[model samples]
Target: MLPAHRLPHLLSQAVDLQVSRCPYHFEPHPPSFSSQIRYSLLTDHLCPRSEFPSETVHILTAHSDEVWFLVFSHDGSRLASGAKDGEIILWDMKGESPKVQHKMRGQTDGIAHLAWSPDDSLLLSCGREDCPGAIVFNTQSGEVKCRVQNSAEDSLTCGAWSPDGQHFYVGGTRGQFLECALDGSVSSSWEGIRVNALAAHSSPRSVYAADTHCRIRRYNFQDMSYDNLIEEDHSIMSFTVSRSGRNALLNVANQGVHVWDLNDRCLVRRCHGVTQGHYTIHSCYGGLNDSFIASGSEDGNVYVWRSGKEKPALVLRGHSRTVNCVAWNPVYPTTLASASDDGTVRVWGKEKAALRQRQLAAASEPTGITGNGDVSESTSERRGELGGGGVGGLATSASSLASEQLDESLSAASLAEVGSDWQLAVDSLTSSMDSSVGVQPLSLPSLSSRPLPPPSDQLPADEEDEDQVTGSISTEV
Candidate 1:
């Protein structure tokens, strides 16, 4: 007879088999509905499977000071991070271990924001208030392409590249918003209340800017007129729009994270419990198809939340100081990178087979007798060995043992399929489901039969208006 503790695992496997056998039953339903069923079957059970590994796989200690900002290239080939010491490091992600490809010097006052051009040929770095200019660099040579100097009375705080890749926009503390050509010429200038954050959306051909008064304004590129999108009660520090342009994530000071539905023009969810003090911390959309939201916390940890969850799904502890930024790999959905005041960038990802082994080992502790006269003495001995150590020590041992199991199970592709299926379920829940469903269902797919759309076909073209040149200037650095 099978052990009572093994029933859940067997039942889960049986459900997976059923799902695989009649894949057509789910084909007729919307992806979101099918995903909801999958998520419920996988996570809502008494013994749940692990969604992702909660440990850091790689630690990158290349920067000397607090790391502030991280951004991946448009094609997701390289990742760039900025630090408090004004150094920008480019990481090559093709290898097993991330290697520094370029270490370029940025603003002296420290880098505040980074934006990559749509074509990925150029990078824009916005400096802190004390610095008078933003720097544009050539991605290949790491050479300074141009310097955009603000007037003595103005300082840049945020920036974004235009969809057409011809010009970029920069916002300053003095409420100055300017459109500049790649050759360092100011095309147009406008004034607003203090601009704190700027985001460009191509589909609407508009730019979204958050001001100090807790107001978000949309500037239409076609009409050159701007209007208020939404006004909040808290000060807006930073915000990022998802690649799909369906939702926007806002970081309100001391108010946690807010998700806004662009179509409905309403707040969908607010994820709390992430420590956000006076300092500015950035949040981003990542995971599979932007299904999860990740942010750095002042409490020296990275918090990840599913789009539908009101609280954090995972709290990753590795940084010794405040974490400042988190970026997800666009091409590879599983990989995540976080930068911190601890002066290191940590990379995280799911380890399927290893995580399963650890979970199975942890769940194997016998609570009752088996069909035999008594449980084996070896099982009792293993339990005693595990219980003999302190909690931290036991956790370490379990991780080590799981790593060993993973080394042996690496040949099996089923583990990889498990992660892939979960990712697909998440993508379907977030992207296909309408707002009427409230929060996305907390579930995952039982089968890995669904294929992901091609990267090119996944993103729609951003609708933007033609650049309207209003002014010009000459500068060199």
Candidate 2:
């Protein structure tokens, strides 16, 4: 009885769930091959995310202005970045060093976001209100294909290409929602709510948009109908959809990143530890099989979290200013890229040399890794002190004591396992699974867990929310 559009979306979610592709699922005893891999993420991963992309391999400084957004191509072979100075730099990521494949310039002001077509043949870029021009570029040749300008009265703010690659959906601050073809033609247009972000779904033939008022809604083009997906107390900054199109990650003002189950239409998890007060922070679904989540923080750090948990499993520090965007390589599980207000883009991944150095350091420690693959008093104490105090009261050192964290010998194998297929990794995951026999991912008790407060319909109390960092513009259009 479901519509044709709805059937495709439902099937995709069912397949993704049946395969146990999401490591965040809270099943007690999952019987799928992916379940074994889930435990690998929790147990095989060490503090500081030992095998994760903790080392910065490349630092790109071509932009004279602060970088606003970053996105990896569908093939994961190239990365494109946009900056406040209106330049788009494409980097070839296949080499030992990421070199500038092409430098594109079109807009006069900042570039708010970038999108790569599903075929990887073209790029759609949304500009700030100062310029209000959307440009489509031929990715292979770095040539401008077409340009779509805003109306004299209002400007476009966000865009995303549809699954069929014929046209894209764009939204404006003044509620101009339209479908535009690549040839600089408008296919269809509508008057919708003011939008801050846009994501397109092919299966359901729908578009999901987040407005400045902290509300998310879905618009089905076929039926010309809409439904509410999420409503938060704080203003929404950005939204990232999962590969399966079943989940979304939202970066909100004053609140940290949140994970929402699109199928269930509920806030599943609120990633904590790190905080955000202002500006749009973009987050993504990454890691092997999209089991892990990563987000750029307003505090200049990149946080990585296990999908099921609320607290970040690892915090990466290095950026000197707010890290506005992050992208993980879809092909290479270990590689990650982050853009910052400090006018630089940094690449991170597992480094064998650094792994060797850590191995030597851990080998020399007086209290080294124990037989059970757990770190000794030295490392455990540091984690304990950090996770000691509770939100209100009680202890939460389960992360420190619940599992053995650092074992140098496990680095190479874990990195390989991270990128391995569940079918092929069954043996390795089961072997390491035995070592983590008793170590379980911690969950807060019901007595201590608090339900989300009812959402308020009032505007955000932060008086400067409108002026401080909304799209780097002085005022909303």
Candidate 3:
């Protein structure tokens, strides 16, 4: 549920008004439940604006080499970004200035992926190619806690924390997926298979992992047994689970992003125009209950889409090289972190362009759930529930702590001197936006996002032989 203080302002927006008036037309799911109503109320506010983020505020250089992955800690107190030069920089998110807490580098392999433990204490860094091992680091002291290496020749590609936070699951290309203890000891295994990505769920007690062979399987988490499959014959690069843990956003090789129904094992939606052909371009669920999806593209731009829309609603263009990944701050709804092959990590939030739009909005209309001071019947009921300290209030209390963290984080003032092109990008975006437009990269030569199709004689690889799969950045398909 939205905070009682935030509700009135959220409901007054143009997008919210339109969605609320004709619920069936705007959202895919019916607003049959109170939570759904709250979702619609907050959707447009926290998401990356169609106004786009080009120059409002962001870090110009957070790494010396190309960045591969970035993830915010659970409590949102810290941000860790891994680079292609085998460097991991941990940033302090508290206060106005984001300080670099640690510039960690021990292993030789370039960083491929990173995951934070449930409590924000331990961070797992998975390496690339030659030495595809996993390293666990103590977040507080910036010390190496443990290292997990593959027993065989396959690269250790992915790792994820269990819901309980006691253990983590690790897998890789042509390697057996294993469940390991905190000390990097394998306790259980799912042998003889290859997994490109993994997302563990607690409610359904299952693990949803990519098959890399145009399929994603829902495995029985307990026994590590295969259960169901989401079938779509497209090469999958990576994935991010939805906030509800009921769905998945998959980065398919040539066909953009696909939302898979975890429960039903089918394609729910296809978010198009993600230029992901030559690499493992990662995408993430961000912006208030995963209401928005942001993806890195080969064309050096970040494509952001509202969860309900199939096309990109906001295009973040700033990186000189290909954007590799994006991570939304968990505590602050509007803040976003993006990594790129330009050898930098860019942070985005409310700044000049965003503030200007807000200022105009404030002058134009008084946004409130109770328009003209007459609250809707449902909204009135919600207000009463908040007073009673019921579900709505409890949810508010949980988020209020997160809001407190937001009050402490770096402001948009933390920015490098932006060139005039930044303002032009923002001004052009603010004046107009066509959600139907395809992904367009700025200041870059046009290249086909499509990959060269596979050979006619080369048959599709089975699950075991997926390492032979073609068309990937550094063999990460």
Candidate 4:
């Protein structure tokens, strides 16, 4: 039997194989989700990415210090951002152009994190204030709906919504995880080491919290009991669990991009050491389909990694200061928003224009490969024409093909009637009816079996091996 903790991870991986396709490569585009960039002479900027030079998207500067967090609505139509300035700003991404929709002020000590309801109608913001430190607001009208003060003495580091959207989980100054309802009533609480980062499974049945001691713990919402996950070498500053809930992407002080397999008892499969800068990951979000993971670091760079790949697909650098948080829109897989210590929030979309230019360049390059393997006499000239366009053109075509394949496979399967012989054949191969073996080959109960058996009965070891080999041969055929 599999360990209970590893069961979820295995099941999720099996489901993902049936429902989704992994990306061949992932890359981070320009940073567009933070505030204004300013260089302080106290320390030289240490940025750890080698992928791109510099590209700016939509830069919105309003805050003075660090813009701590960014989160999106369930539909991806709206966004909410929090910062050290103790203010929250909302953005409308569905508009023709991304624009700040509304701004709400609360929490005197500064906003540490923001959590949106599963439906996206209500948003919860937590910070350090004298009395009521936590507040909930309506995203549509910029209205303050409710506030909960003295719930926790310190700043709220992170918060998550329950799977059914009924309970909210908050972690911070209290050294515990509190379960509260929509009305702000505390339902249950689990106390532990001080938590710096937090995440919950998509089902919301379980919660994962990380502390300053470099330890991760899982808490069962039902019993309020917790289990200590394996401790790493560095403190778990920030982490993001995949949408499929099978694995997590974590950033340790010394280890970067730690992929923990939730199905395998949270086993650490691979660690892609991010030495881009000497800092920790502040914020991260997994892709909607769980294909990739994106993270914002104190090094002022955004890193993107394909779900199971060891190396990062792309690194985006533009923020002159450290980035505090990064969020990706659920509706648009390629669109990202971020906030930084420089007091800016920005939005970035894939550069279709730049891709087009690359395609045009490659199509005109010299001939390298064709029906014949040898390079032609005009190879150099042909390469010059094809090199530029080839890469971009290939990307566009591959994406199109992948989309079509996904649509075709995701549709539900249909059951239809078949011939009597086929029915008999299926029954002979699959039926569980008990009957004696017949003398006539055609009349034998084993030859023509409806539904397959439960696979409880075992054939001889040699026969079982033969059957396995034959099954593979038939599938190949």
Best by TM-score: 1
For candidate 4, the per-residue lDDT at 282 reads 53
Kindly list the per-residue Cα lDDT of model 4 for residues 1-477, writing each as its tens digit: 867658545544443442222222233321321211221122222221111111233455655567878888878888888877778888776533455677789576778778888788888887642323567788778898766544445446577777777777777745656777778777887765577667766656577888777777787878767787657877766777777776767777756667777667665555352442444445455554566666676667676655655545455665667776778877766667778777777665544422332343345444322222221112222223222446554554334433333322222120113334544434443232213221112232331444333121122112345333111101000
TM-score (all chains, Cα) for each model = 0.67, 0.67, 0.65, 0.60
CA lDDT of every candidate? 0.67, 0.67, 0.62, 0.56
| TM-score, predicted candidate 2 vs. hidden true structure | 0.67
Arranged by TM-score with the best first, the candidates are 1, 2, 3, 4
For model 3, name the residue pairs that clash.
8-369
| Per-residue lDDT of model 1, residues 328-373, tens digit only | 8777766788889888877765545323333333344342112222
Q: Candidate 2 regions off by >4 Å?
A: 1-48, 353-477
Candidates 2 and 4, the one with greater TM-score: 2
Q: Which ten residues in a row are the worst by lDDT in model 2?
A: 468-477
Q: What TM-score does model 3 achieve against the real structure?
A: 0.65
State the lDDT of candidate 3 residue by residue for 324-374, as single tens digits.
888888777566878899887766664343333223322332321111222
Candidate with better TM-score, 2 vs 3 = 2
Report the lDDT tens digits of candidate 2 across residue range 46-98.
22333467655455666888999999999999999999888998888875456
